[model samples]
Target: METSQTHENSIKLTSTEDGIHLDGSILWLDSKHTGDISFLSNPQSATSKLDSRVIATEETIRILESFRKKPKALICQYNRPFAIGPLNMELLPSGVGLGGASLWVETNNKKILYAPQLQPQNSETCHHMQVRKADILILSAKTPYNADANISRKREKERLIETIKKMVSANERPQIFCEPYATGPEITKILSEEGINVAVHPNLFRILKVYEAYGSHVGSYIQHSIHRGDYDTLLKPIPQNKQLRRVFPKNPVISIEDNQGPRLDDGLFRKIDERFYIPSSCDGRELKTIVPKIKPREIYIFGPYAKDYVRQLRSLAPVVKALFPRHLPSLF
Candidate 1:
């Protein structure tokens, strides 16, 4: 446990066997934790098995219904302040995926912001990330410091559209594999705006319906059908089986993978005509730019590559600490 003096009082920050604790409240940022009150940050966290009073954004609660997993969750809207005991908490858009948010808590003249999966970039299907000054900032350090971090999502989207056009022109069916919750909706919205016919997997279709309910313009899409052969493009999750060639033998297969996950081996899909990569997430360079704007008095890094993030942010923040869990508790 670490104690920091605030204007009129002191704030307690600690990581215990349960999870990250701010004062006495427990935070479940896309992780499961046990406490009286568990503040969830995103859809992933809301659906987690948590034996506590769960609180999440309104969108997240709706998404949970789509998954058919109901937990008694207290709903709150973005930028709206709600009280839980002595803490005044508000949700801010995290800009990572659908229904993603950052938690901001204020108590005793001190403010703390918890954002585990933050992306400052705007998406066509989701809200832009909102930043605010805080006394303490707990951030995730998952993005690697590399050249791929600098790739522009705008250019990548354009490139993906062009490639899909070329594949269609050559009488090939372009199958795009992406993460269902994060990149799927954005890509679908972009392709739909371009007037391209897109078919999504059943699970993704359910999620898109939730997004539509929240007023996100995901455009027009049909659920993927094994019998239908009219769509120009097909969007689905990464396949566990490599023998996809046998399933769609009528059209020449060209797979365009969203580089959000592991790269598929060439031998796994020998029949694939071509493959392309499009990655997402806020990189190390962007994190540096975002932190200064937030103007946090103290910063704590957690998640993958915590040491690297700590080193990079040490000079930018007044006090930078790494919260790498020794017992592998899911702090993020």
Candidate 2:
């Protein structure tokens, strides 16, 4: 389901009685959108080395050819609307890069934020410092922040609170999900009193243990323990890992695992360079400023490259860039 294929392109995902056909760098799929990780379990089969010369023409042709053989219905998600085969693409805020086009939505219903996989420290400014209104912010609040020791100690909770103050109107109310931290718990307790829901998923213990801990918590909001590879960079709570080098701090008393690894870093997002992105969909103009400033070297990772959206980014100017991850570096 994942590939390093990037180009000035349009995607068509068709679902037929047989299976789904993805007409992009990927071709067709013969199953529900269960996800791409399971099929590509082997490192050899899943990973591909891709560069520009082949990106636009050759790679596009190759994947297009692959889909020709599948023969299924087609569906496309562009900007706000989506198209399924012949159906018109509907208009709704869309999410990019975080698996499919669903991430750009936030409903008013009693909702749960399932953020996982990304290192929290890296996005301290983008995720925490910025105010976003969510009924519940299900942070990957794993403790004993050994993986990236520098971030484990960062004042992320305070930043998130400050950001929230900037976002929600004075009358709005929301809650926070957190882990059992000296400060996070206290802050949540205070917020909960003011009508902002502050709750924690005790399952965070699995992330704090000395060993690669495992546990099953049949809870309302979560399922399996988030994988090291799949957690969202903006929402994932920090974990203990090799990023810390030496650990076993006196404060937590958690042990270490020999096979532990660091979260994905700069080297990971480089594969498929996109031209346009939809960060949050609030301000279209601001989104434009975010592009090129962070990682100018990388190609536009879906930066309103299409003739249609490109005009929107320029028109929105500053807000359009707000639709994507503020902290992650640009890719080429």
Q: Best-fitting candidate, measured by TM-score?
A: 1
Candidate 2 accuracy as lDDT:
0.23
Stretches of candidate 2 above 4 Å error? 1-21, 24-121, 124-200, 207-286, 292-332
Predictions in order: lDDT: 0.71, 0.23
Candidate 2: residue 107 Cα off by (Å) = 35
lDDT tens string, model 1, 1-332? 32222222446565544456664554444445555567777765443466666778878777777878777778888999888777888989888677788888888787888887777767868889887888888886654544255566677788888888887888877777676676788889888888889999898898899999889899889998889878899887655453453335555454545433444334443466555545445766778888887788888876556667778789987778776556553222
TM-score for candidate 2, residues paired by index: 0.21
Error of 1 at 290 (Å): 1.0
Q: After TM-score superposition, what is the CA distance of residue 184 in candidate 2 from its true location, in Å?
A: 8.5
Error of 1 at 75 (Å): 0.6
**What's the TM-score of every candidate structure?**
0.85, 0.21
